[model samples]
Structure formats: C-alpha cells, structure tokens
Target: MSVLERFSFNHATAKFWDQREAVEACARTGSGIGLWREPVQEMGVEASAKLVQDAGVQVTSLCRAGFFTDPTPAAIDDNRRAIDEAAALGAPSLVLVSGPIPEGGTIDSAREGVKEALAVLAPYALERGVTLAIEPLHPMFASDRCVVTTLNEALDLAAPFTAEAVGVVVDTYHIWWDPEVWRGIARAATEGRIASFQLADWITPLPAGVLTGRGQLGDGCIDLKRYQETVDATGFGGPIEVELFNDALWARPGAEVFAETRAAFANALA
Candidate 1:
C-alpha cells in the first residue's frame, strides 16, 4: 500500500475532534482509525460501529481497555466490555495500558496483576476476535502509569498467551530510546506478538504532566523512517497508526489535523 493507504490516525491526535468527522476523514483519505472508548460510548457502541462500517473505514485498534494493575472484578468486567466493543466495531486490537502501581504494592506485584488479569481476559478477547495489545509507556510513567516500560517487558507479559489473544504494541514514542528495541521488534515478530504498530515523535520540554507531549512526525529526534523500516523488515504487514497526544495538534480543526498528520507521516517516512 502507498503511504496514505497505510496510515491510520488515532483519534487522540485530535482529542476534541468529533468521532463522526474523524471517521469521515479516514474514509475520504482511505486511511484507518484508532478509536477511543469514551467517544465510541458517547455515540453508543452500535452506532459507532455502524458509522465506521458505512464509511468503510477500518478501525485498526481501540484506544484503551487495560488498567488491571489492581485487577479488581470491576476492572475485569470493564475489559470484557472493551473486548465486546472492539468486536462490534470490527477492530482487531484493543490497546492495553497496565495501570499504575497500587498503594502498598511494588512494581513486581503490579506486573503480576497484569499477568493475572490477562490470563482471565485473553480467552475472552480471543473468543471475541480481539487481540489485547499491551502498550508499554515510558519509564517516567512507571509509577502512576504503565508499569510495562519496555517492548521486551510487554513481550514477556504476552508470552503466556497466544498472539491471537494477546500481543504488544510497537509504539515509537514510548520505546524509541531503548537500545534493545530493535531486538524486541524482531522477537515480537518471531513470536507473532506484534498486534499493533503506532507512530509518534518524542520532543523535549514535555508539557506539564507530560501526558499530552507526544510530538508530531518529523518534529522530534526519532528516526521515523528507520523505525518503520525495522518493523517492516520483520514481515509484519499491518496498519501503521499515527497516535499523537499533542495539545497543539488537538487545538486545530480535525480535518486540518488529519490532512497535516497524513502528510507529515508520508514525509517523515520518505
């Protein structure tokens, strides 16, 4: 596929963009989309599914559905709901962010919560034809965010289950700085565990809280082209979703942001 054809825009890139408009833009551009649960729920799951289906826009993956570090019964129930939503929307992957370290819990204990949660949900996800794609955040987020901080760690977590049920997200913004990232990519491919591939640049002077600080393509030090090339080398032919969490991009009109992000992706890859 050409660059535009291979692109999938994650809705968080333009946080306030109307879900309908984002779906329409992806349809018009022949691109895919990564949807978040809130907007999908706002429109209602069935309506959201119909919107994408009618537009012929592939929902590459759902934004999130994991925070089971504490793994309460409520967490499991919510994840089951997320799996159902992904199936209804025909999205192949549901992104999983292992939640923060619980009070009176160590990182190791929190990781075990993830494993326990996955063991419970993996079968359900597989039954629903959704892959639970675990996304490792930057180490900065280790305490209050994702405890899984490396692709290798994500892979280890996924190893207990079949790739069809659970897998890892190779997101550049989070793992670009890891020296062993290439090895992690290769290993993921070898194990058939790369369920989702996302792109975002890493720029300095992270915004307050650093949550919405992901830079646009070509705006940071990440070698976007090389990262794509490396993943492609593993023979994982799948949608490449550009998932930016940038305040500036979110402030613009959705359509404009969509167009600009697509161009930026192509140019950065070029």
Candidate 2:
C-alpha cells in the first residue's frame, strides 16, 4: 500500500477543526484518524462512535488519557472512562500523556505514579481490546506536561504490562533528539509494543515553547524519513500519524491543513 493509505491525521494538528468534517475527509481518502477525547465527549460518545463507524473511518487511536501523577481514585476512574471510550470507538490504542510532576513530588515519584496507575488500568484496557499507548513528551515538558521524556523510559514503564495491555507511541518529534531512539524503536517492535508511530518535525518554538514547536513534516531539522524507515524496518506496519501542534497550523483552515499534511507525509517518507 502507498504511504497515504497508512496515513492517520491526528485531530490536534488542526486544533479547531470540526471533528465530523475531519472524519469525513479521512473517509473519502481512505486514511485514518486519531481522535481527541474532549471533542468526542462534546459530541457525545455514542454519537461520535456511530459517526465514525458509519463513515467507515479507521480510528487509529484515541488522543489522550494519562495524567495519573497522584493516581487518585478520580484519576483511575477517568482513565477507565477513557479506555471505555476507545473500546466504544473501535480505536485500537489510547494515547497516554503521563501528566506533570504532582504537587511536591519528585519526578521519579511521579513516574512511579504512572506505573501504579498503569497497573490499575492495563487490565481494563486489555479486557476492552485497547492498548494503552504511553507517549514520552520532550524533556522540556517534564515539569508541566508529561514527565515521561524518552521512548526508552516509556518502554520501561510499559514493561510490566502485557504488550496488548500497554505499548509506546514512537513520535518522531519527541524522540528525534534521543541518540538511542532507533534502538528504542527496534526494542518496541521486538516486544510487540509499537502501539502507534507518529510523525512531526522539531524546530524552534513560537513564543510559547516546546508544545507549539512541532513543525509540519519536513519543515524543520528532523530526519523524518529516517525515522519512518527505521520503524518500517522493524516491521511495524501500522498507521503513521502526523500530530503537529503549531499555532500557525491551527490558525489555518482544517481542510487546507489536512490536505497539506497528507501530501507532506507522502513526500517526507518518499
């Protein structure tokens, strides 16, 4: 199949786009979608699920559900809901952004909290046929966003659970700077834990910093093709999602941005 067939457009790439239009566009192109929870919930879960199911759009993975720094009962409950949402939507994976270090907690301790929270939710995820995909944000985000900073660390965190129950998101923008990332990709493949393979480029941030710095595919300095090749070499034949978070992209029309991203994915990996 062509790379476009394997393309999955993540919703946040065009943050303000209408979810239904996005799904319809993906359906028309025979591509896939990575959905975010807030919009899904806003549309009503069952309604959103039915919309995608009817559209025959592949739900690549649910956007996010992992902020268990403290692992409170509330946290566990919310994650459980997220797993249920993924199952309901026919999504295979639930992307997790292990949240920031909790109040007065050390980074190590927060990570441990992720382990604890995963232990509670992995079985739930496995039972529902969804993988909990742990995504490591760049280290700059360790304090306020995700504490998990490397693919290796995310892999290590996923180690205790069965691969079907937990896996890692190999997002190029976040892992491109890690020297051992290629090794991590191979390891994820060997372990049957490459739950999602995402694409984005690393570039200097707009005024806001790391979160907004994901350049369009090939727009920045990241070797996106090499990353794609390495993951493909590992035999991970799954959706390659482009998940950019640039304000500039978000400001454009969703249809225009989606079209550009789809073409970019093909050329960057060519």
Candidate 3:
C-alpha cells in the first residue's frame, strides 16, 4: 500500500464538537477515523456506524474504554459495553485510557486497578473481535487521566494477554519525551503488541486541566516521520492516526480543521 494508506485522523483531533461533519470530512478525505464514545453514543452507535460505512471510511479505533482504575464490577461491565459498541461500529481497536488515580488513591494502587480491569474485560473484548489499545497518557495526566505513563509500562501490563485481545497505542504527544520510546516501539512490534499508532505534536504552556493542549501535526517539536519510519520498519502496517486535543482546532469549523489537519499530517510525513 501507498503511504497515504497509512494515514488516518482521529475524530478527537476535531475535538468531538461536530459528529456528522467530522465523519463527512473523513469520508471525503478517504481517511480513517478514531472515534470517541460519548459522541458515538449521542449520535447513536448504529447511526454513526452507518454514516461511516456509507461514506466508505474506516473506523481505525474507538477513542476509549478501560477507565476502570478502581476495578469495580460496574466499571468492568461498562467496558464490556464499550467493547460491544466498538464491534457494532466496526472499529478494529478500542483505545483504553486506563483512567487516573482514584480519589484518595496512589498511582501504584490505580495501576493495579487497571490490571484487574483488563483481566476482566480482555476476554469479553476478544470475544467481540475488538483489541484493547492501552494508551499511555502523558505523565502530566498521571494524576487525573491515565496511570499508564510509558509505552513500556503498557506493554508489560499487556504481556499476559494475547495480542489479539490486548495491545498498546503509541501516541507521540504522550510518549515523545521518553528516553525509551524507540526501544518501546521496537519491543511492541517484536512482541506483537502494537494495537494502534497515533500522532500529535508537543506544545508548551499546557492549558488548564491539560486536556485540550495537544499540538497540531507540525506545530510542535515531535519528530513524527521518524516514528512512522520506525514503526513501518517493524512491519506494523497499521493506520497512522492523528489525535490532537487542541482548543484552537476545536473552536474552528470542522471542515476547515479537517482540511488543515490533513495538510499538516502530510507535511509531517514529508
């Protein structure tokens, strides 16, 4: 396949502000999309699935599941439902955020929660033909978003499961600064743990909540093409997804944001 075949845009790059427009844009661009659960639910999963299916667009991965850092039975049930949604939407992977440290809990304790949650939900996801892509959120988000902070950590957590059921999401914005990133990528590939590949440039002056500050493709310091080359060298051959959480992009019209992001993604590859 051509390099274009490797390109994809996470709908979250458009910030979930407009669901229909985002899907339409992905269809028009012939790009794959990574969708979030809330918007999919709001639009109705079947309806959203039909929209993408009719548009001839691939849903690379569903934005999230696995926030059960507390490992409650209810949380595992919720993740099982997410797996069903992903299957219904024809999403190949279900991105797992692994959630944050629960209230009055330490990061270590929260990580244990993640392991237990995964053990509970991984089988269900496998049965549904969905891979759980454990995403290592930036360390800045360790307290409130995800306890998984490194690709290596994610892989270690997934070691007990089959690759078809558990794997990791390599997102530049989160793991770029890690000294072991390259090794992590190589190890992930060698171990058959590369469930998803995503990109976002790193920007400074992080916004409050640090949730919406992800940089556009070429706007920050990440060496994106190098990552693509490395992963491709490993024969991963999966969608190269762009997932940005930027307020500026979210504030713009979805059409414009989509166009601009496509251009930036191509330039990053160049």
Candidate 4:
C-alpha cells in the first residue's frame, strides 16, 4: 500500500466540525481518525464507539487524557474514564498531554506529578489494553500547557513503565525544532514506545495565544517528507495522523478542510 494509504485525519484539524461528519469523511476515504474526549463524551462514549464501528473507520488514537500535573485522586479517576473510552472505541492509544506546572510549582515539580500520575494509571491502562501515549508539547507551552517538551523527556518519563502500558506521541509540530529529533525517533522505535504519530507544521509569527496557530501541511518550513521517511525507517507502519490546530482552518467547513489537508498530506510526502 502507498504511504498515503495510512493517512488518518485528526478531528482537531477542524475544531468545529461535527464528529459524525468527520468519521463519515474518514470512512468514505478509507482513512482513520483521531477523536477528542469532549466530543466523545458529548455523544456518549458507547454511542460514539458504535458510530465508528458502524462506519468502519478506525479510531487511531484518542486526542488526550492526561492533566495529572498534581496527580490528585480526582485526576486519576478522570484518566481511568479516558482509558475506558479508548478501550471501548478500540483505540489502541490515549494521548496524554501532561499538565502544566502547578501553582507555586516549578517545571521540575510538575514533571514529578506526571510521573506519579502515570505510576497510578499505568496498571489500569495495561489492564484495559490501552497505551497512555505521553505527548511532549512544544516547549512554548511548557509553563501553561505541558511539562513534557521533548521526545527524550517523554521517553525518560515512560522508561519506568512497560511499553504496552506507557509510550510516547511523536508529533512533528511539537518536535520538529529539536536538533536531536532523529535520534529521539530512533530511540523511541528501538524501545517500541512510539504509541502515536501526528503531523502539524510549525508556522511563524504564532498567534496571540499560540494555542491555535498550527500551519497547514506544506505551509511552513518543516521538511515533511524527511519526517515520514524517518518514522518509516523505524518500522512503524501505523496510521499517520494529521492534527493541525489552526484557527483559519477551524473557521472553515470541515469537509473543505479535510479535502485540503488530505491533498496537502499527499503533496508533502510526494
């Protein structure tokens, strides 16, 4: 099969799209999808699961379920629910964006909180046959969005746990700037810890808040083809999810955005 055959569209690429419509689009294109928790919960997890099953669309990975920067009991319980949802949807991985530095806490302390949270949830994830994919967000988000900011840091946090229960998410948007990204990918592959892979271009003059400034594929300076080859070299023949979080894209109709992104993905690789 062609590399594009494994293409999966992440729903967040068009944030306002209808969940069912997104799934239908994926099914129509023989593509997979990455779902978000809020929409899944809104539609009811069981019903959402049934929708994907009926549509014959694979749920590549759940958007996220990790904010245990404090590892509170409530936090653990919430994550347990996320794990259950992933299992029900037949999604092998639940992406985890370790929460930001807690109030009065440093980045180091927040990372420790992530460790504690993972320790408590790893067994639960293992039992459910779902991997908690620790996603290292861009360092720009370190203080308020995520403590984990690099593939190596994510791998280090996951090292204490079994690969089956804990792993890492390699998103080009987040790690493309790192000089050691190639080595990071190699190490992640060697350890069998690449739980999820996503693509989002790094755009310049980031937006005001910087949370929704992701550029469309081929719109930025990132070498998309190189990333594809690097990941493929690792023997990770899994779904390649496109998860652009751009405000402009989100403002457009989902169908339009999907078509454009699908084409962009093909072109970027070609």
Model 2: residues with Cα > 4 Å off, grouped in runs: 205-207
Off by over 4 Å in 3: 207-209
| Candidate 4 lDDT (Cα, 0 to 1) | 0.94
Give the better candidate number (2 or 4) by lDDT.
Answer: 4
Q: Candidate 4 on 91-118: residue-level lDDT in tens?
A: 9999999998999999889999999999
> Per-residue lDDT tens digits of candidate 2, residues 1-270?
888899999999999999999999999999899999999999999999999999999999998999998899998999999999999999999999999988899999998999999999999999999999999988888998899999989999999889999999999888888998988888999999999999998876444655777899988899988888899899888899999998999999999999999999999998
TM per candidate comes to 0.98, 0.98, 0.96, 0.99
lDDT of 1: 0.94
Q: Give the local distance difference test score of model 2.
A: 0.93
Q: Worst ten-residue run, lDDT, model 3? A: 202-211
Superior candidate under lDDT, 1 versus 3: 1
Which segments of model 1 are wrong by more than 4 Å? none
lDDT of 1 by residue, 1-270 (tens): 776678999999988999999999999889999999999999999999999999999999997999999999999999999999999999999999999999999999999999999999999999999999999999999999899999999999999899999999999999999999999999999999999999999887777748888989998999989989999999988899999888888889989999899999999987
Prediction-by-prediction clash tally? 0, 0, 0, 0
CA lDDT of every candidate: 0.94, 0.93, 0.88, 0.94
Question: Which pairs in model 3 have colliding backbones?
Answer: none
Winner by TM-score between candidate 2 and candidate 1: 1
Ten-residue stretch with the least lDDT total in model 4? 202-211
lDDT of 3 by residue, 57-144 (tens): 8999998888899988788888888999999999989999999899999999999999888888889889999999999988988988
